[model samples]
Target: MQCLYFDQDVTSGTLTIDDPELAGENLFDVSSQRKRYIRNHKYGMVYQNPVKGLRMDFSSISNIAEKQIAAGGRHVGNMQSAGERLLDVVSIPLFRMKEEPRNFSGGMQQRVQIAKALSNDPPILFLDEVTTGLDLSVQAAVIDLIKQIQRDLGISMIVVSHDLAVIRMLADRTLVMLNGRVIESGLTDQILEDPNHAYTQQLVYSLL
Candidate 1:
């Protein structure tokens, strides 16, 4: 569902990248190669499971640096420095740079994945169930980190989660999906407080 908005192979509906280089180009109509390029150069995605988004066996530095390399980075020193800085920003100690994410705690692994996603400085980010399965404190800390990064970088973020608390913290707008369809859409506060659809109302009430 998140992929539909970002030019993944959806069955129908028009999608377009708003960047100057790809101005008004219909994403669904574009060639697959072009779509791949757009995804590689314009967006970042963090999956719910770190394994899906990160190389578990690679050192954290290597995982983060790989994104830069894929985006055309050539200088090893520059890439290494950038990776270390991002890891520091994500609250992972620089001493852990040589360690693989497989050895880190769940929260730490998620942080490494986040660092890797941001390695290319993409304008848009997609997060799918990022806080699921984390301890409450760890989840809160990671959410705060994400919020800070969004504010500092001013990057566009689309977060997908069933957790209302997570949505309330990170989202300005909300789309309440029932099954595969969006049954309600509005500002996050409004959707939570004054839902228009029955499904949305029930969902919100359960949370309360």
Candidate 2:
């Protein structure tokens, strides 16, 4: 993250991933600002690579609780109890709440991400190929979890993926993008069963 003055001048930069920032208030300030933005938006990105994306050092519960804190909700101040509750909500045992994310299995880490996203209590959740790395059983569980969350919170979703099966399962509405343009879009079942565009038809057929 880069810190800039209100006048658009670069004030400082913090690269937490890089070895260059051994000790710096600049990065903390910038990351804080980013966290604030994420909290306000109530949207999250569940990246495809768990190893590369999630904070390996932060306990899964802490990661979720931090977002809740940034969102100005009733979560940050009571982390000890709230964090455990969140892990439970995501189906993680209370024992795992204190463990670092690297200790979790792939599916578990993804659940951690979901729990974290919901911590902010956002009205929408955008999942990018959420089930790509999971086994079939885990994929179904994850999909069911998303549906249940939507029902419970009345949240909307925009699931970005190239997999037709995944889109069919998750999206009420479907959109087909090609070279930056939306080639087809509508009710998911409609797009799947009776596509209007040739590209969409091709896509559906290929899925068969």
Candidate 3:
């Protein structure tokens, strides 16, 4: 919700880095080139659909390497090493580095997408419904992997998901939104167990 660039309905706000405020392009305006630079260098995004975020026909390593390549990486060996290390970081096997993501399982594809997102080593990562379509076991594994990555890298993440389980596992603070407005905001455990808002209470009960 913080990054309203992807939201068509968002109309007002300021996204800033340091002192100069970045007008919500959705509201005010921004140069395309500057937006591209901000997205490429400062923000890493993993979409719900792997195909939307990844090059399905490319090798997993190639998909990850592209980020580095865009960031001015020229050495093949270094790029390949970084790719493999990212794969390992995301719990993907090194052998799959040469394989296309189109052939991987949904869980594996998600992992590859995560690796690609981290390729630039961006300070902020935005994950939009990342575990949406995976099997329950796979969802659990992916969530665990995300938690581990956060612990090891200390990268801040903004995760958007309707799944309460994911919030419980990965979020420290929680916000419950209804009709584009936040109805409740508090510590994850407190929000889940003792929701003050009526809608939030219903959401909690439905999950139980």
Candidate 4:
């Protein structure tokens, strides 16, 4: 198996990916302008904290519209329509579309974050510990929503989470990591049923 490594410099807030196959080259080698273009136009990210991904004071509709606008949407009517549609898609009531996310529950804030991420209609979505800090029932609901979105949108998603149950629910391929190294990877069921590495076995057994 080919292993990909990510090193982040906490002090500088810089992240480097050391995977040739994944990037086809060093991602950081690209010009800053090109990187910005790719980030704005090609990728969507949902942070673990809704506060990181959202403007807490902005109305949910404005939050969605902000992304659309960033992606070059100019027509007010079109942006409004798209924002409303995305809000509906994420299961937020149309009546509450104008409410600030800060006033909503944890689950609702995450849903708004998801809506905003999808506003750009990017082909790839990256979710980072998206269910953390939510109740079990809320986590399950968010996971279900993610699955439904995947089915309906048919977009590629990279989900990062420490929860084994969340991995089992969302992933077809699994990569087991230990101390920032990918120790094992394969089809999710294969790994779960017959983990080769000792650590992987322990994880699988613990899930039982």
Candidate lDDT scores, in order, read: 0.88, 0.70, 0.83, 0.82
Q: Candidates 3 and 4: which is better by lDDT?
A: 3
Instruction: Estimate the TM-score for candidate 4.
Output: 0.87
Q: How high is the lDDT of residue 47 in model 2?
A: 58
Question: In angstroms, what RMSD does candidate 3 have relative to the true structure?
Answer: 2.8
lDDT of 1: 0.88
Ranking by TM-score: 1, 3, 4, 2
Which of candidates 1 and 4 reaches a greater TM-score? Answer: 1
Better of 2 and 3 by lDDT: 3
- Tens-digit per-residue lDDT, 96-151, candidate 3: 78999999999999999999989888887888899999999999899989999899
- Model 1 poorest 10 in a row by lDDT: 1-10
* Candidates arranged by lDDT, highest first: 1, 3, 4, 2
lDDT minimum window of 10 residues, candidate 4: 1-10
Of the pair 1 and 3, which is ahead by TM-score? Answer: 1
How far residue 95's Cα lies from its native spot in candidate 1, in Å, is 0.9
Give the per-residue lDDT digits (tens) of candidate 4, residues 122-184. Answer: 777788899999999999899999999899998778888878789888988988989966899
lDDT of 2 by residue, 36-73 (tens): 56434445556566754467899887787667666665
**How accurate locally is residue 103 in candidate 4, as Cα lDDT from 0 to 100?**
98
Residue pairs in collision within model 4: none
lDDT preference between candidates 1 and 4, better one: 1
Per-model clash counts, in order, read 0, 0, 0, 0
TM-score of each: 0.95, 0.76, 0.89, 0.87
Q: In model 1, which residue pairs have backbone atoms overlapping below 3 Å?
A: none
